[model samples]
Structure formats: C-alpha cells, structure tokens
Target: MKNLLSLLTIAFLSTGVFAQTTWKADKAHSQVSFGITHMTISEVEGLFNEFDATIEASEEDFSDAKYTVEIEVPSIDTGVEMRDNHLRNADFFDAEKYPKMTFVSTSSEKVGEGKYKVTGDLTFHGVTRPVTLDVWHRGTVKDQKGNLISGFAISGEVKRSDFNLGPDFPEAVLSDKVVIDVDAEFKKA
Candidate 1:
C-alpha cells in the first residue's frame, strides 16, 4: 500500500513538472514591424531587425501563457539609410540611451479559436504602459527536419504621447499613433 502511495505521489509531481512547455523564437523566420502616419496622409513603415522572444505555457490551451519579447532599438530600419540614422539618435528613439524595448504579458484570455487577447506592459523609451495585443495562433506543424514549429501573428497600437515621443515631434508631421505588428515563429525547446 505504501509503495502504491509513493508511486502516485511521484506521478503527480512529474505531471506538474512536465506540464509547462517552452518555445524559443526563431528569429530568422520572424519579423517585427511598425507603422505610423508619415505626413498625415502617407504611412511610414519600419522594421526591427533584431529581437528575441520566449513563450511559456501549460500543456492545455494557451490561455495562461506567458510571453516576453525584447527588441533592439538600434536595429530600427525604415528603408532609408539617412532617415534611419536620424531616427536612431537622441532626437528620436535615442537608441544609445535606451538600447532595448520590451513587452511582457501580465494576463491572457482566449477569446476564440486560436485567438487571444493578451494584456501586457510595454516598456519603451524608458517608459512603460499597458497594451493589449490581438494575438492569433497560426497553428503548429512539424518541419522537414522533424522539429516542432508554431506561428503567431500579433497586432497592437500605442500612443506616442504615452511613451514620451509625442511632444518631441510636431503633430502635423508625425502623429501620436504607432501600430505594431509581429509575425513570428517559434520552435519547441
């Protein structure tokens, strides 16, 4: 009887230990981009070439998942070399002062199939604010190399005013709204 009890205890302990899975971002197959109004009529898009993310979740649905992502500020690219350099200086992102920006999930809710409303604190320009991202799980599959892969598409918006970037730029030229989009893939680790 004691041996049976010991077996049961070990089973439960191992179940808890193995329930959580970790996924590492596949940066080569992922992208993070942003868009904002350039002249109130045209949109200017930018991409961050370097970023990292990790996802941790229980074996069940990802309703309780935890997400963390960091983007290197110096990697900002807007397709124009001159403009990119100008934006990287202290007048804009001040990449030297704030080398990285990050987003960490505080809560997540599964609203529908493969969709989630994730609320998190976005820290940028040395400031932090709450943002809710619309996240969609693009499904999971196995690669030819026999590796598990998962994809996600995330979208959200933030007010530049909330992050100390609004007052620095003239409203007529650069709006206070910034849209973030991330289409990323992760490999099971």
Candidate 2:
C-alpha cells in the first residue's frame, strides 16, 4: 500500500509539471479586422480594437489547442467616425443590444504543418452561426518579458444578411458577404 501511494503521488506531480505550457492573448499586439463590398466598387474596412484570445497547447504541437475569443463590437473603427457610429447603431451591430461577439472553437483539424481548419460557433448581433476559419500558426517564441508567445492569423467570410445586419442599403451597394481577418498573439498565461 505504501509503494502504491508513492507511485500515485509521483504520477500526479508529473502530470502537473507537464501541463506548464499556456498561451494568452497580448491584446495590444492583436487585431481583428473586417471588410465588405460597398457599391461593388469600393471596400469598406473596419477593425475591432478590443479583443482577446486564450490558448492552451502542448510543446509538441498545436493539435491539442483550446481557444476562446471575445470581441467588443462597439470598439470598431472604420477610419470614418461617422460610418463607425452608424455601424454600431441598430442597423448593423446594434452594440447596445449585443455589445460583444464571441467565438468558441468546437474542433480543429491540421491540414498542413502549420495550417489548420478550425470550426467554431460565431455569435454576432444576437445570432450564432457555424463558421470555419483558415488558421495559420506563425510559430512560437519568447517575448521581451521572457514569456512564451504564439502567433496565428485566421481569415473567414460570413454573410451579413444572415445576421440581420442591414435594412436600408441596396444589395448592389452592400454585399451580403463580409470578410473577417484576425492577427492574434498569445502569451503564456
């Protein structure tokens, strides 16, 4: 019984030691931007300035990664303050009603050495949809603070009408498709 107890303690300690790797978003260094067609001739670009992500993976690979992302829709900037304000209103994001958007990963599949196909449920404007993001793992390294960091870039497109985005603009000027791009940096948590 003494030998068994000792072995169990050693196993528990080893598990804790091996679970040291963790990654968290460096919000100041991350960005989430989106673009969509405007009048079929110009593209309107906007970015959400406040967002964060959490990541946990083993040193061996990102296959075991778990990710959760949250974004503040009211913090969107389109370079034009007027347009940005309108976007935050009821016609678009309705920031007052749905102040935030989020994505929680459901599954991830490795398609290449540093590339993955991630499927998650994206909640926006009081609606949720299953979206797939093409994710590229840029790599991992140590930051100036001596913390481990991981970088990733993801891009995907979703239909605005599917989320009840607009009611005034004509289909010609406002395409249903919106392209989203994310450049995220994660640090050791």
Candidate 3:
C-alpha cells in the first residue's frame, strides 16, 4: 500500500510539472487572416481581429506543442467596409447565427527543425472538417512583465463549399478553396 501511494504521488507531480509550461494566447498580438481567389486573377483578403488560443509547448523542443484556437467571425475586416459588411451576412459567414469558428488540435508532430504539422478539427459555418496546418515556431522571448512569450505562424487551406457556403457567389467570381493564416503570440500562463 505504501509503494502504491508513492507511485501515485509521483504521477500527480509529473502531470502538474508538464502542465506548467502551457501558454495562453495574447489576443493583442495574434491575428487570424484568410484569403480566397477572386476572379482567378485577384485575391480577397480579410482578417479576424478578435480571437484566442491556448498553447502547450516545450521550451526545449517545439514538437511537444499543442494548440486550440477560437475566432470571432464578426470581427472580420477587409479594406472596404462595405465588402466586410457583406461578408458577415448569411451569404458568407452568417455571423448572427454562427458567431464563432474554432480549431482544436488532434495531433502535433515535428517535421523539421522549428517546423511542425498540426492536425485538427476545424469548425466553420456549422460544419467540421479535419485539417492540417504547416506550423513554424518563430522563437520565444520575454515580455515587459517578464512572462515568457512565444510566436508561431501556421497556414492551411480549406474548401469553403464543404461548410455550406457554396451557393452564395457565382462560380466565375469565387473559388471554393480558401487559404487561412494564423500568426499568434502566446504568453506563459
């Protein structure tokens, strides 16, 4: 009985130590942006200004990192206010019905030095799809408050039609594929 208790104590301590390295998103320093082909020659780009993410990363190695991110769809901004307003309508994001989109990590593995492949379930427009992002660690530093800060950039592409945003635009003007970029900073929590 004493041996079993000792083992349990060690296990609990190890879990606590592992969790201490977690970092939460610094919303002011992070942004999620997306771009889609418009007219096959031009691109339309937009960004979500309000979002949050939680990251668990190892200071010694980035492969042990994990992330979960949430984005507010209504916060999207394009260069033109009219275009941005249109995108928030039912024809596009339908922010009134689905105010947010989320991505939760399923797996994270290192592909090369400071580079990784992160697989997750991405939910958008009430549909969920498994997606993979090419992630790169931009390094870590100390903030003004002396908290550890880490930066990462990830990119992926998803088919907009898969999420039921298919019939909104004419096929000639819009493509189904949309590319997403995530540039995030995390502070040790």
Candidate 4:
C-alpha cells in the first residue's frame, strides 16, 4: 500500500510538470487581411504577407489564452505595387518608423457558445489603442501526423484617424474605420 501511494504521487507530480501547452501559427494556412471604404462608395482590400502569432496556456480554455501577434507593416499588399508602396510612406502606415503592428491580448471573455470577446491593445503607426476582437473558435483536430491543430476566425475594426494613419479627407477620400480579419490556424508546439 505504501508503494502504491508513492507511485501515485510521482505520477500526479509529473503530470503537472508537463501540463503547459503552446500553440504556434501554421503560417501556410493562416491569413490576415483588411478592408476600408474608399470614396464613400467602394472598398479597398489588402493583406499583410508576413505575420506571426501564438497561443499559450495551461489548458485549452482559450478564454484564458495568452495571445500575441505581430504583423510586418511593409508586407501590406493590395495586389498593386504602386498602391502598396504608397501606403508604406509617412502619410500612411509609415513602415520605416513602425516596422510592425502588434496585438497582445489583455483579457478574454466567453461571450457565447464557441465565441470569445478578446480585448487587447493594438499598436500601430507609433500609436497604441485598445481594441476588441470577435473571435470564433472553429474546432481542434489531430492531423494524420498526430499534430493537434486549432482554428480561429477573428474580426475587428480600428479607426485609422485614432492612430494618425488616415488621409486628411477621411470622409471624402477614405473611411476612418478599417476592418481587419484573420483566418488563423495554429499547431500544438
């Protein structure tokens, strides 16, 4: 009976030591994109070609997730070289001054079934502001290679004027609100 108690104690202690879990971006299957209204009539879409994100926690309750994401500002692509170049200047994203836009989650709440309201501060163009993202946890699956993968659909909006990244004529030339979306997949790391 003493031996049995000793073995059980060891097993319990070992489980705690190995309980930490980390999720890393599966970049090839993840994407970050944004859209903004143009001329009060049309919309312009773009994407960041380079980004990295991660989810870390003791368990799979993403409401307790430690989330961080970084996006390369210069990687913004609108499928037009000239437009992309123009956006990288001081008048816009100013990739030279702020090479990356980042989001580090401060808190999360389970707002509904399979949905979470993630509140975080987004830093962009030398400015930082609080933003809330509506995140939907798609599901988790184990692949043929035995790697566990999880998916999330996230969307949020930021005011360009708040970050001093807007055109002078925000109402006439472009809208103040920019909508961001991410279809992200992460693998157990």
Candidate 5:
C-alpha cells in the first residue's frame, strides 16, 4: 500500500511538471497587418495573406508563454496591385531572395491584467532584429464545437533602415518607421 501511494504521488507531480497547452492560430479568424507612412503625407496599410502562428504555455495567464510566427513574404497585399508588386521586388522586400519572415519570442512579462510585454527576434528581409511588442489577451472562450479559443492583439514597430528595406527610398518617400498590428485567434491544440 505504501509503494502504491508513492507511485501515485510521483505520477501527480510529474504531470504538473510536464503538462503544457499548445495553441494554433485560427487562420480564418486571424490577421497579420502593418502600416507605414507613404511619401510622408499619408499612411499606407498592408497585410500578409498567408502566415502561421503558434503559442505554448504552462500557466493559465500565459506568463510563461512562447510564441512563434512565420509569414510568406510574397503574400503582401496593399489594396493596390502595383504597389504590392513593388513591395515584393528588389526595391523593397526582395521576396525572391527572402521568402519568409519569422518571429520567435524570447521572453514574456505580464504588465497588468491581461496585458504583457513580449520581446522577440523578428527576422525580415534576411535581417534578424530583436523587437519588443505589447500584447493584450482578449480572453478565452469555448465555442459551440466545444473547442477552446483565445484571442490576442499584438502591436509593435520596426524601422525600415534597420533591415535595409527600401534603402533607396528616403524617409520622406517611405517613412522609416513601420507599425505592425496583429489580431489573432488561437484554437487549443
């Protein structure tokens, strides 16, 4: 009886140490987008039509969460086909040379209720740079299909010159700062 009790205790403790939840981005409900100043007169927005994101967490509040995202460089769309094509060319992203942009979180710290500061390495245009982004947990819910879903909003900024993107264009032509916004829904996996 003592041996059986010891074995049960170990099993319970092991589960706590090894258990983690994985969440996959629901593509139908998620968006990866960005905005940048155009000619220093107005802002132009664009989005990547194809991307993948995943999160792994052990804590319920996601204080120990890790995130990863990959975006197809050629999938950029800016409502104007000409501009989109330009963005994918050598003058901008050079999609033929760098086909994928990715990000991986290095640390996450909870700042307030449902809010966190996530620092990660963002790789774009063949350049990798560390960036810090603000993240908001919109909450979690169960869908009619009995699947658990969680929503998150992420916002940050990156400099065009940092990655040598559109190097030929001056700040007046294409603002150096590019703003990023992501709204994503993850289904428990």
Candidate 6:
C-alpha cells in the first residue's frame, strides 16, 4: 500500500510539472491586418476587426507552443465603406457564405533567439491549405495587475488564388499575393 501511494504521488507531481499553459489574446492590444497590391500601382491595407487567438505551451520560451486563430470575415475594414462592402460580396470574400477564417498550427520550430517558424492549416473561403508563418516572440512580462502577458508579431503571405478568393480577378486588378501581419498580446489564462 505504501509503494502504491508513493507511485500515485509521483504521478501527480509529474503531471503538474508537465502541464501546458494557455494564453488568450488580449483583444484591445491585438490586431490582425493584411495588405495587398492594388492595380499594380499601390498597396491597399485592411484589417479584421474581430479575431480570437490562443496559444498553448509547456515551455517558458514557447518552443513547443501551439497556436489557433479565428477571424470573422465580415469584420474586414479598409477605412472605406464602399470598398469594405465590396470585399464582403461574392467578388471577394463572400462573407455571407463563409463567415470565418481559421488557422490551427501543426508545428512550431524555434529557429533563433525569440524567432519561430510555425506551420499550420489555414481555412478560408471554404478551403483549407497549409501555410507557414514567421513569428517573433516579443517576450513576456507581468502587467501592473500581476497578470502575465506575452507579445507576438506574426507575418505571412498567401496566394489568393489558392483559397479561391476573388477567383475572377486578375493579378493586374489585384495582386495575387496578400501579406498578413498580426501584432498580438496574450494574457496567460
């Protein structure tokens, strides 16, 4: 009986030591933005006003972190009402049919000091494709309220054609490549 109790105690302590920590994005401090070339002349920038992201990690350096993100398609804003509406129509996102874009990380590899290469499956416009994004772990700190917070700057590029986004549009009208940039802060939860 004493041996069984010892084993149980050891198992409980091991589980605690290996427990994963979860962090949720602090909405007010996070932004999901994208940029695309327009008319082969200038870049048009936009952002999704509503998004949720979470990270799970067991290491302090976040080398083993898993990330998941969901963005509302109808929340896209380009600072122009007409353009935003157009983007939501069938010519572009078709937000009525597909209202959300999501990404679930399959792997995260630490390549340098505070730098990571994250690969994931991204689902948008009713299509799922593999994508790799560069991440800069901007470190973590304790807030004034004693809450732990971490910051990340993530960037990636995706071909709109791959996701059937604006299928009829030519590269001349709008660049096929779109750049995604996210500046996010996560509070430990």
| Number of the predicted model whose lDDT against the real structure is largest | 6
**Any runs in candidate 4 off by more than 4 Å, and if so which?**
1-18
lDDT of model 1, residue 112: 98
Candidate 5 lDDT tens digits, 18-46:
67999999999999999999888999999
Q: List model 4 lDDT by residue over 1-189, tens digit each.
A: 999999999999888965778899999999999999999999999999999999987756576787899999999999999999989998798899899999999988899977999999999998999999999989899989999999999999988988999566556898999999999999999
lDDT-best of 2 and 3: 2
Number of clashing residue pairs, candidate 3: 0
Stretches off by above 4 angstroms in model 6 are: 1-13
Model 6 TM: 0.94
lDDT: worst 10-residue window of model 1: 57-66
Model 6 misses residue 164 by how many Å? 1.0
Best-matching candidate per TM-score: 5
Better of 3 and 5 by lDDT: 5
The C-alpha TM-scores of every prediction are 0.92, 0.89, 0.87, 0.91, 0.95, 0.94
For 109-128, candidate 3 gives per-residue lDDT tens digits of: 88998899999999988999
Off by over 4 Å in 2: 1-21
Ranking by TM-score: 5, 6, 1, 4, 2, 3
Q: Write the per-residue lDDT of candidate 1 for residues 5-107, one digit (tens) a residue.
A: 9999999988996688899999999999999997789999999999999999984456778999999999999999998998888788889999999999999
Q: After aligning candidate 3 to the native by TM-score, how far in Å is the CA of 86 from where it should be? A: 1.4
Task: Give the number of colliding residue pairs in candidate 2.
Answer: 0
Tens-digit lDDT track for model 6 on 42-148? 99999999999999998889999999999999999999999999999999999999999999999999999999999999998989999999999999999999999
The C-alpha local distance difference test score for the whole of candidate 6 amounts to: 0.97
Evaluate residue 153 in candidate 1 and report its C-alpha lDDT on the 0 to 100 scale: 95
lDDT, each prediction: 0.91, 0.87, 0.86, 0.91, 0.96, 0.97
